[model samples]
Target chain A: MLLPHWLFSDRAGLVLLAVLAVLGVGVPILNLWVPPDHPLYLSAYTVTVLGKYLCYALLAVSIDLVWGYMGILTLGHAAFFALGGYCLGMYLMRQIGARGVYGDPVLPDFMVFLNWSELPWYWHGFDHFGFAMLMVLVIPGLLAFVFGWFAFRSRVSGVYLSIITQALTYALMLAFFRNEMGFGGNNGLTDFKDLLGFSLQADGTRVVLFILSALALAGGYLLCRWLVSTRMGRVLVAIRDSEDRARFLGYRVERVKALVFTLSAMLAGVAGALYVPQVGIINPGEFAPLNSIEAVIWVAVGGRGTLVGAVIGAVLVNYAKTWLTGALPEVWLFALGGLFVTVTVLLPYGLIGLLQRREKAA
Target chain B: MSELVSELDAAGLHTPIEPVDATHGILLYLEEVTVSFDGFKAIDNLSLYIGDGELRCIIGPNGAGKTTMMDIITGKTKPDTGRVFFGQTIDLLKLDEPSIARIGIGRKFQRPTVIEPLTVLENLELAMSGAQRLDRLITARLTGEERDQIHAVLDQIGLTEHGGRLAGILAHGQKQWLEIGMLLMQKPRLLLVDEPVAGMTPAEMERTAELLRSLAGSHSVVVVEHDMGFVRSIADQVTVLHQGRVLAEGRLEDLQVDPMVIEVYLGAGDAYH
Candidate 1:
């Protein structure tokens, strides 16, 4: 297929693609082909964790699409991410059919535990993989469209928009925590068996999930890059810089914003859908405002407007988080806080920006 | 109001607007308009008109409602009373800023606002009148004809060599000229220019004056300028606004000597020379 010239011209994007290609090919080989006793063997735990990082990276890119390029600092993207996960989790719950502690074929363990007579109306169609996949995109997209339509139309922007987004996720977190909300309550959806007949616990399934995540991250990156490269992308940047100027130029500012916001939310949804199976659970904790803020920190630390920077930042920060949380559990939050403050005060443009500046200087 | 609705219905019935009804020779009309902010009237019962393809200059002291009048004409501010019309048929009051701009009225702000992060060429391309639909914008590529049009505008603005440069890096005068170039890309029949030469060097001001003069025959240009020399160089007819009303309207030479014009300027400690 023919690609636009701008896509090919992005050197950082090409580098990112090459790296994902290497991971896509290399991780599977090391995990499945290499002998388990060998020094080079990649463990399943490591594979699952790496897969989770790729999901986070995709989420970061989604945040960057709106915050970095469009100047909308979304603080509630985790809500979309959690909502997507819940949609897929519902399907996974149905996949548990007759295998739960209560052995209820029609309803999930939580619903059975709660004495529900039948599956809720909303969960009726999640059994089919295709429908679940469609919901992964649609649920988040519909929420974003409705939210953005009202917010952008009323011109709620800047820090106010960010605050409302945070409130949105916080509200979701509260609602999902309720035992009567039809989801798994505070514990969220878990105890999944398989997806599309492939056992999620099997090493081959794990490897495939990781590969899919890498692919999704790559796809998400390209979609965002393509969007920012087009004339519409310029319009987004124009809106970011001076909204009044864009309006005066005859562009429908609110429509453009709502469209991009919906697209970004859908992308975040894809990331979350891929996340649940690898992690073995989806919980209300994923809807925390802190998770959304952490995603923003990743974008800021990587480079705000650069798509590659989001990926790089997500992986790097999460790697540090893994190490810190494991080594000194109490210090992890402090370390994360320190890192954000340091990045904000010293490195405004982020790691990618610093690299670019050095290249210019050279 | 009924006429306004019928005009809108007629506009909806046809994709292309029947050329703005300038048959009576007036291209813009602001009749008995009033605007208030916090119980203070900014534009108090004002009426103004511009002839078809005419270049008009409006000069006034600070807080004399010069900018407010432009706001009303461009749909940025709605009057509490009275009607604003684009030619004889189109009611300007009913439209939003983007819709007003689409219907051949372009505005240049006082601060020379351009998308600083974009290249000069990109800025002009964005301001072009067509291809603003969401689908078109998503897949938009610069066609050969469009590129040629952008190049023509670059030359017109005397920024042909600077087309590839970021707009933010351009000098203040160049940024101003680039904004004017953006307005030109809109193909507006009426241009509302607010202080086009505020901080321009004499040479830059002379060029801007020439550009505005050249645009007069094909476009009705309403310039609100504070600089008397720049106004004198470009305007054939001038309107003096004081306390939100027309103090005087005539040739600059005639208005300069008017007792009321001098008193308004002098009382406000403003040097009109």
Candidate 2:
């Protein structure tokens, strides 16, 4: 069992994998085998929440791939996430055949309520789980490709690129909120039932989904880690440090940016797809510009340019967010803003950098 | 040797560049080129020819369009009017910066520009002449021969021991040499080096002069430098530019003594010396 040099050398990555493995295997046993009364028993609710955190962690990693490594501060990644959620949500909607309030066998509840006679052309393929899954990867990927092609080709970068990405998610939020867009308006696509013949509400299904989320995070981390370790990864760093130098080196800078952006978006889509089932909702609200910015804050707090830092940051921030929002809901937004400012000013390299410095000092 | 050529060919080392046609003895041709910025001419009716394997020094006062000229040749700036050609067939104006670079023109900026976060070896590797296509880049591993080439460049640039060190940590002179090493990795047909010895110590400048002189016959080297002493040490031919046009073209000795050249440029101050 000789490990590849990249995996062998990565201490943080190994630790991340070990933690994920423990969670993936340990959570299920604790939830299923241990009785509810036992102190060691993990509730299904806790498992679902942990699964949601993994999904957020995956999304943060996706953002780091582009923002941390490629130097494209995309403040619109939530658009990809929401789009992926909507894709899976559509499938779930179809799965609710004759189970909705309107009891329409073919049309979803919203469509029946709106008096639409048939499914939209785009909604036709989502009925099939495989197609829905493919869309989960493709739709966000295609949008990123088209957007990045125009943006990078035109040489839109730095703060301008960031602003445009923010605008992108803002625009999507407005469109998705429209009832005429065919995605469930403000109410969004919810009221899902079973997936692949397994009820999402069941404890077994919940456990499996949590494991899958963990697996997805681990896989996404490895994929990004491998990519950044390659020569292409060096090219990306070169582009980030100096675009002109990369271009003058005869590397196609725009194409690389666009391709990496598309890949990052696809990763976000997978995170979102995993998210929808665990949370049992996919709505326009997910596309809020603040959600995208918060994802970037997670990357910054954990540490930019280190793949493992993103997961740590996302989980820690969301964990704090969960607690803070529960304990002092009025102060959550302020705390988040203060944290971002503090990280930017004091911990420019983020927590990983601080730890690395301490290790060197020791 | 043939196997090596084929290996490099498969690796796309020699694919993008059409062999430069310098049979007529000219490597680069810029004729009647004019570029303007906001109604002011940055380059005014500039006509220049670089002979094959020539070490030509371009000296000019500030606003004389020396940097602008390099920009035009490297496809960074589009000339409003005129013909720019690489060898005889490739119209340089038609290509973008990366394409221009791929087709064998490499430019070093006035300030040293290297990927500081990367190690010196990785910086050189990125600049190596080969398949920069996404698929190739993603899967690219250094062949023994490629590693050898990188080692050769490291030795050439005198950074062999520092290859593993992050480029950002290198001294000013070392970074300049590393940049030149990167250009060497490109295997460029023509090298456009701008102000290579601007802030270097006398010893570093001497080494840089020696390096540029050594690079001439193998690569057509056009050096734009301000330090007259440094320029005199390496320049075989000198082109003096003034107000976006060639003021004089001759040996440095002849240009230094030319009254018109002296009046506009050389007479500026002892600062140039």
Candidate 3:
């Protein structure tokens, strides 16, 4: 398919696609062909890490779309992300089928342990991969639509709206943590054997999933680029700059906001679904408010309005986290906080702004 | 309800709007419209009328409820008691701002409020019909006529050369003109223009006066301005407002001598300047 002209023309976007394409093909080659102990070998663990970062990058892009373009700072965005994961996680659990510890073909291991007789009605079609895939987009999208409809219609915006979104995720976290919810309680859905009858443990499966993650990130980026390039995207920018003026121009401000928010949430959901199999577990912890805030931080530190900046921020921040946690585990939190403050204070437009400044100077 | 039914039937027979009723000679009407903010009457029993295809200029001093009156007409503020009508049929009071705008009333605020990030051309595009706005979002393409309409507005606003520039970078006078251009793009039947020449140069003000003068006959225009010279240049009928009531109303020549109008608005020193 011919991509939007802007995506290929934009230097950062071109660089992003080139890098993703290289990583997509090269990582699998290194992991599969290069022998371990040769120092150049790619480990299974690193593939998972890179794949997970792609997911985070996608999530950060989702936040950037709403917060940067539309002026909607949704702090509860990870609720949609985790909700998408849980939808896929449910399917992953159902895939365990006869292989689970309880070995009940009809019920997941947790349900059997809880003494439930049958699968919940909401869990019916999730056994089918296609149905689960539909859900990964729909559930988060529907939730966002309803939430944004009420919020935008009431004109609750700015920091107050952000606070309400945080309250929404915090509420969901408490609910999902309960055993009665039938989502594996605190343990979450785990012990996935395979996806589509292929052993998930296989090098081929991990490599393919990794490649798929890169494509999904690229696809989502292009889709967002196309959206913002449209007149509607300009309207989103208009709304961010001056909402009342937009309304005066006969644009239904609430409808526009609700639509963008829902779309952004669905993108976040896709990120979450990709995240689950690679990580192998999801729990109420995924619904944590902090996770969503961290996603926003990624967008801010990278560049709020720039699409490639989101991916860069997500990767750079996560990479810093990985290195920090391992190298100075006790000081990780302080270091992360310091990084956020320094970026926000010094590099207000983010690392991308720094690059642009250097480019101008040079 | 009976009149509405008959009007709807007449519109169905015709192409939506029949000629203005000769009995009132009014395209827009306000009767006993009063609104208070914490015991201060922003609009106090403000009865006013505008003839079809007439340009009416309203001049008032500070806190004279000029903005509040526009707010009421555009459905931004609900009057505690009054009737606001567009033509003979539609009740402006009963509608919301969007609906009022849809029903052919457009308002420009005191301050220029352009969507800063969008180009001048894109801002005008957003002000088109809602269907067109949605179409712009889904497809970046535009029909030939829509493109013409945008160029026409750019030319009309005298910003044809700056169509590609972001509105955020425009001068204050340009932003005001851009906003008026946006309102014009909507093709509203009635325009409630506020402070149209607030921060304009003498030359810019002359161009604005000419723009308002030309717009008057095809579109019923209500220009609320503090610039006495600009109002004199364009007003067919002038309304002088004081503490939310029409203190005086006449041709600008006659109102110049009315003691109430002189005392409230054109103070002794504010004369002929």
Best by TM-score: 2
RMSD of 1: 2.4
In model 2, the clashing pairs are none
| Model 2 spans with C-alpha error above 4 angstroms | B1-16
**Candidates 1 and 3: which is better by lDDT?**
1
TM-score of every model versus the real structure: 0.96, 0.97, 0.92
**Worst 10-residue stretch by lDDT in candidate 1 chain B?**
B9-18
| Local lDDT at B155 for model 1 | 95
RMSD of each: 2.4, 4.0, 3.8
lDDT of 3 at A12: 89
Per-candidate DockQ versus the true complex? 0.80, 0.75, 0.57
Q: Is candidate 1 or candidate 3 better by DockQ?
A: 1
Q: Can you list the residue pairs that collide in candidate 1? A: none
Please give the ranking of all candidate structures by DockQ, highest first, separated by commas.
Answer: 1, 2, 3
- The true-versus-predicted C-alpha distance at residue B263 of model 3, in Å, is 3.9
Model 3 per-residue lDDT tens digits across residues A298-335: 99899888888999999999999999899999997787
The candidates, ranked best first by lDDT, are 2, 1, 3
Model 3 Cα displacement at A186 (Å)?
1.8
CAPRI class of candidate 3? medium
- The weakest ten consecutive residues by lDDT in model 1 chain A span A1-10
Candidate closer to the true structure by TM-score (higher is better), 1 or 3: 1
